[model samples]
Target: MRDERSRRAAPHRQAAFDGPGAQAGRGGLSSLTRRIVVFNLVALNLLVLGVLYLGGGRDSPLTQYRERMGVEAALIGNVLEVDPAPLSPGAVAQRLEAITLSPGLELLVLAPDGAVLGRRSGDAGAQAEASRTYVLDALGGFWRVFSGVFLGDGPLPEGQDPLGQARAMMGGLQPGAPLSRIAEGATGRFVTTLMAIAPQDRVLGAVALISPLAPLDAMARARQERALRIFALATLVSTLMSLLLASTIARPLTALATAAEVGGKRDPQRPAPARVRIPDMTARSDEIGRLSGALRGMVAALYERIESNEQFAADVAHEIKNPLASLRSAVGTLRMAKRDDHRATLLEVIEHDVRRLDRLVSDISNASRLDSELVREEEEAFDLLALLRSLTGYLGGQAEKQGIDFMTDLPEGEITLRGLEPRLAQVFVNLITNAMSFCQAGDAIRVWVRRRGARVLVVVEDTGPGIPEEALQKIFARFYSHRPASEFGTHSGLGLAISKQIVEAHGGVIWAENMRATGTDPTEGPLGARFVVGLPV
Candidate 1:
């Protein structure tokens, strides 16, 4: 019972494994769709990054905080410049208090060494102490935490204190340069500026404007959170849309694939299914619609061609039967003749008729079987140069017997190609035999093999009266012949037709051209023609 269950489940498991690989085999369209979707998503991400990099600072809340500090620095710098007097502690405090305003500002004057020189605020002493102390103390704590989060945690190295660093950076500024600028510090970001208080730009002291780091930090965190939320939302929407789109697109393609596989396996008598109807795409002029149209056209053409070939095969078989019967009767009559002389004459006539009948039957049979037999089989790698060498050796004696010179321009390297060897050999034989028959005394034939791009080209040139220009295109049609009755003594007119069928079967092309004799190349005499066959590698 366990074995039976496993056996039953095996097909289903195999089917599951085979499903994706089968879809992958549907050619370029499947790969093209996936590439398009991935490219779209990458482009969207890059657009977002570009927006952040260029415009992020202009919209940040930190810009407001920096402007407020700049106003205070300007006021302090003006007072020190105009008075030019040494200020006592009380006088300095009074001077700071006079300029203080509501929504309030705190002032601190620091000596160049960073010690506090004077401090003043608008409110009562205790209240002022509470606000001032809170703001001032929060500065270092904020720096510690900010440094930990953003700039990284550590004690200041010797000569590397954050405030001193700010002053040193500001010292490089030219007179009349902007007094305040934004800088990111160990704790957080700050708006720092310097003022020339002593005469002739002598450095007596500096006023530092401090703000708490929370408001700007909070705004930035919020903005980032909002951007992340938006991104998540967009991704969720895109995924849902992708699922819907993939299903919509993949379902029709899956149906088409199933139909094609079924058609391939079906017996000729079995009727095809009703045409598949894909929704939402029929009315639109898009790639999918064009694809659907092309498939329908292909199925119709295939059915017609199959029907025509079957009917033609039946007709050919029926037509050849009568000629074969006559030839058999002639042979029987010759066998019964009594005298040698009588028998000899009768046998010669019978043999001549038999040969004619045999040629006719062979041509008819080849014409009927051409299409079906020419269908592509397995493709394998083979050396064209080696194949040509073998063919030349086989046909060389025949050409010599006919009093024709046989020559070859074959290279030695292995020109690797993918094709059915037997079919290719058949095409080569037909072309060479046809050339040999027309090649006259002192005439020569040359066979050349070379590689061009991803295709291998073979050319057979013969010194014979070239085919007329008008006959070139029609030479490959069934039963086509350029030979008049004078030349029809041994010709069946089916060789070129069979050669063409074989060439087209391998997805290659063949054509003929008149070769002009130039200078001393005797092989390319005035009457010579060249037949070239090109096959993909």
Candidate 2:
């Protein structure tokens, strides 16, 4: 039966785990994995851009270059103005030779009428600074065009001296006033400042200082290239690491799901798989491990329940067959009997068999429902002493009427317990009644209760013919009856089994023992049968 059930259930279980819906869940990248990689890349790329694009402070090279150009232009104008050498080319050249100049600078001097006076070109360092590699020059050209088109960077005239353009733009100059501007030159961009040479409110000529912008552009391009290399490398490494991490997580999860599905697969030759061996991930110390452990336990419990049900069904079949056979025999014998006394005897046998069968069937029904009832019922706190008092009070009179002594030794205060009240009552009632059935006119049945540390113990002892040593263990088994033939049909033998089930359901234990006259000697004659029940306080 269990095998048939498992076989029938297998395909449905497999479909639940491996169907289209499950495939869909496994198809795309996990959201967590996507978020991990994407968010990391975004932050890293943003940081790279911020560091590259964020310009320098006031003390940057460009600001210092502008200041230096202005100071140099003013110094040149002052020198030419104070010369008193008639502003001749020879005098200006001699004066320029006497003044010190910084690297990467070109000087232009003009007469008051806008005629060229003298020119002092840049030194060797400025010439070296102007040189560029093929890659850099191409990149620079592309950048200029791109910026001009998209970033609104205006193009400078290709074949002109930027200082000359500055001079042309500033037609008139005021004394002691310097003007600075950036303009494209024949070679590259230049930062130029024009300062007027004047004395006593009289305007003379002007001196213009020019510095190349190529050095700054080259430095920026080199830094940007290095930054881009780092960004690309970082993104690649991070992406690979994120994917590896995601695989570690998802692979194990997928394996677990697959294993779970495999456990439910149907085999034509076998009832169930040898075992549903879920992967043992308990050592992982994570939620997956805990889940694996929980699943393993549940599967084990389910198999145990299945086995128990199969055994129960087999036992029920075997037990019902005996009375059914007897009933069939008695009915067949009755029709053949000619005498009335013989027919009457056959009828009595049939009635007895029918009653026994009815009792057996009723007990089996209750036993079958016991497990579900224990699970479905709710437990509440109740006083154990009060429950016992009510039982002993009602049952004691019945025992007295039957010429048997019924005694109870109950405790004083409230013995509170949390459990199904009616189920527990059924257990004690069964125990007490069984003791009563064994006892006669002179025999005594005593029920006692006591608290034992963390647990409460209840004992039902009977002073009757004690249980046989061989039958003691088997007495609690299903359909196992050891009563006298006179009371054969009165008891179904399921009472103790049901009691054991109820006790175990409440996390308690029940056991039967033969009470000996001497505690230390095993050879001593048995005095009575003792049933003990222990429950948590």
Candidate 3:
């Protein structure tokens, strides 16, 4: 039997010890840490992409290159305007080339008659040679595609370089103002600045400065590299911080979930497992901490209830056995006895035992079902004083018939309370009747109520032999009785226990104490037994 039980409990035992990793194996409570880190990294990268796009569109290196080229072109036109020598194609070209131009610029001089004078390369000849390398061409191609997609610009037209494009625009046109434009090239784009070299409005000629956009492309690449490096560092830091936050949340919640799983299983035929301790997170002062405290409290209540039920069952068995054994002995005696009077006495003994057994069974069944009934019942506001008046009026008549003084000191007007009325009525009824049972003829029983702050107190006092000091705490426990010998078989011990269950279910308290003559003398005999019930009002 032991081996079979162990086999049945093996899985549950394993479940109790399972950690978050084990739960994750079963796809339970997935890692919030991973999700947090992933989301932060993704958002960070998106922000970087947006910054790159916006920065490249409005304030790009290409824009700066055009502005610089325009300034250089204006300066060159000024230099040509001051020269006093007659214009010639060779002279124009030679003079222009002598003036050092910014790198990657090509200079062209046109005659006043619209004849092609001459063209001279600045530093462009060397740069053009370098630009033809496979590596440079490939890098320029990549930059062109990248700028096209993200910066809302497209590739340059085929078969057209910046020089040819500028010459075409300058043909058959007389400039009235300094003009700047972008021209496409085979390998890249260019910034072209045009200025009329007309000294004193006589139109000496026009000088065209064409600057390659390769340097701007390099600037853009460098900018992008820096941006990416910063993004990577930010992503790393944000992801680590997210992981730490997730750990604070996920680990404690996981522990709580695991504890709930282990303790929450209900098996009627099996004994309860060892108590599971929920992790204490109450110091956090957050929602998770509140949840932890609530769960711990719930588990404590559940274990206490389970232990109480186990003890109740054992007590039930023991109580029933006493009556059963008495009846059995009585029956045997009745069968052996030959005298009529002896047989009659044996029959009465058997009857009393049978009655005792019946009472015990009835009370046991009611007590067993009390917990569920208390949970299922709904509470409503009612007049507490009115309910007490009704009980005292009805039970007082019964006390009078038994020659005992029944008194009530109930206050006037209604004291309102919210609770299951019938259940609370049962509680008061049990307290009054139990007190009456302890009292004899000529003894007095008093039932009274008093309001104290938010609570209403109900006291039941009887002028009978007070309970023993040792039994005061145990009086409300199931099957615990302190009645006289003659009263033993006549009453079941569940009345006070059931009363306590009902009172507590309504968020109230019930306690028994001996009423003494003076406040503090332990040697003095108790005047009577007093039962006090306090309920929220």
For 88-193, candidate 2 gives per-residue lDDT tens digits of 7877888888776677777878777767678787664534343334455667789989998999967556766775676674575677878778877778777878
Error of 1 at 349 (Å): 8.6
lDDT of 1 by residue, 205-251 (tens): 66655544544565565566566567667766765665556555664
lDDT of 1 at 411: 79
Compute the lDDT of residue 11 as modeled in candidate 2: 44
lDDT of each: 0.65, 0.79, 0.76
Per model, state how many residue pairs clash. 1, 0, 0
TM-score of each: 0.47, 0.66, 0.72
lDDT of 2: 0.79
Give Cα distance to truth, residue 113, candidate 3, Å.
Answer: 11
Candidate closest to the true structure, highest lDDT: 2
Please report the candidate that would top TM-score against the real structure.
3
Residue 55 deviation, candidate 3, in Å?
2.5
Q: Model 1: C-alpha RMSD to truth?
A: 15.0
Clashing pairs in 1: 143-187
Judging by lDDT, tell me the better candidate of 1 and 2.
Answer: 2
User: Model 2: runs farther than 4 Å from truth?
Assistant: 1-237, 262-277, 517-520
